[model samples]
Target: MKNDSYPTSTIANNTKRILVLFAHPVPQQSEVNIFLFEDAQLLPNVTAVDVYAEYPDFNINVIKEQERLVNHDVIIFQYPLYWYSTPSILKEYQDLVLEYGFAYGKGGTALKDKLFFCAISAGGKEEAYQTDGFNHFTIRQLLQPLEQMASITNMTYLAPFALFGSRSASREDRISTHREKWTTLLNALATEHIDLDRAKNIENLADLTINGANE
Candidate 1:
């Protein structure tokens, strides 16, 4: 079920309608993203859709998904990083929902000027995602396909807000702090308080402070 219950009229002026497409294969086993999804539900002007819950059979409703995309100003893919990419359902959703005549190719400008980014929770440590580290690539580098997808669809791509070391976060008591940061990031995006230009330059949105400190 989609949480499109929040009315647009109740949202404050100058705020954008944000759509968070959550895709986790096993939410019952998740430590971070489940809480983050709940936090997004409490916020105004944010429509959070659990894609797995909505399409358990992998039968995506292209029209409805496209409509949701058209109505929102920002699109966020919220999920745990599974095998260096999104979960299977999310990839299916994109392949089906984003069609040739709608998302890209000729006369496919339905998502033009919309903002896109990922909110990811990874099992590896932040240091492990560097050029010379274990993964041998930054999260941004690993997510190049989605960035290019956004570019072709005419959406503005922002650096992801990622939480590294997620596997031990709950045991180390870091989940709460990460959840709080996720909420803050969502609020900043909704209210247009974040610096889009600066966001584009950064590798991770989490490193940029919401206030004037990081600029």
Candidate 2:
């Protein structure tokens, strides 16, 4: 994928900047992630990028992605939870975009002091991800690799924004509450209202309540 040049802006003295990396293979078939990306893109300080649309062949431009990272204060990885992890393209993006000297290892200060987060949709129900539930392991446990990645890169890893019961969500349900959740999440990221410490302490992103402007 070619590097698409976007206008760079100075981070506000007291405001948090956020970058949302959205990846969905079949957007036409998505029930929740598409709405989440749409809502997230409306935030003033959030730069939302659709990876699948940009790098359809998995040829990621590492330099361009790193440049985007350097310009943002917070980073968000948004996608659906496929096979208990991110989509294949997202993993490829991670392997390519987050390089050895730019995102981690020595002299990799580009992501330093920045925040990292995940926004995901799961086909399973909320109760299915519990210890005694069908899925067995919790969502947080499933995301340990990402948390370790953040730790290795010296970024503050925040809790995820998760939408559960996606497979059963009706169109009307998505239009009402789910869309509102996406809007609230975007607003929170743009305004620095997200509590990273508290978010990290939670076991499931679905259980975390976002206190938005309407609330």
Candidate 3:
């Protein structure tokens, strides 16, 4: 299913296409990411790619990945944070797929005007990512690299969608609530309910509570 976007969902007919690149090293053992990724795949007009599952060999085909990018309207990089960044395979994919004369440079407008952001599951609690916290840097601060990548590529870089404390003890109800919000956010993104300006202004999608919905 290389660059595949079959119409499995009937949520919206003429909405923008969504590409969710799901990267988990070991999904079966995962507690939070598994549920998040599973729910995302069920959304209509959304192409969710389990990167590791698709390319277990780590030998990602650049052409196929680029083709998928060109064909989608919204792009999501969903993964569990490792060492404050994406997993190795996704880094490898970027180095190979986002090449010269393609994603950047002359005639490299495949991703222009497209929505770019990430959905991350981190072990650190929300407060841990603040100035006075142990981590000392906000998620937004740490994710500047990807945000810069979007800038250079001429894409619209919105605030990230993050879930903190993935490894901590959490109630089943809390996890269920997170899933509901995740699904709602995906639907909003697909249907263009997200106001790009407002999304860009906030720190993350979870902050939507303070800023109100993207509508």
After TM-score superposition, the amount by which residue 212's alpha carbon in candidate 3 deviates from its true location, in angstroms, is: 12
What lDDT does model 1 reach? 0.87
Q: Considering only N, C-alpha and C atoms within 3 Å, which residue pairs clash in candidate 1?
A: none
Instruction: State the lDDT of candidate 3 residue by residue for 50-116, as single tens digits.
Output: 9999999998988788878887878899999999999988898889888766777876666878889
Better candidate number, 1 or 3, judged by lDDT = 1
Candidate order by decreasing lDDT: 1, 3, 2
Candidate 3: stretches off by over 4 Å? 1-13, 209-215
lDDT of 1 at 47: 96
Q: In each prediction, how many residue pairs overlap at the backbone (N, C-alpha, C within less than 3 A)?
A: 0, 0, 0
User: Model 1, residue 147: displacement in angstroms?
Assistant: 0.5
Candidate 3 residue pairs that clash:
none
- Candidate 1 per-residue lDDT over residues 1-215, each given as its tens digit: 22232123233567789999999889998889999998888887799999999999999998789888888899999999999999999899889988876788866777888899999999999999999999999999999999999999999999999999998988999988887778778878877788889998898988877863212
lDDT of 2: 0.78
Candidate 2 lDDT tens digits, 45-138: 6788999999998989877887788788888899999999999987897888777766677655567778787888888988998889999988
For all predicted structures, in order, the TM-scores are 0.91, 0.88, 0.89
- Report model 3's TM-score to 2 decimal places: 0.89
The residue-level lDDT of candidate 2 at 184 comes to 70
| C-alpha RMSD of each candidate structure in angstroms | 4.9, 3.9, 4.8
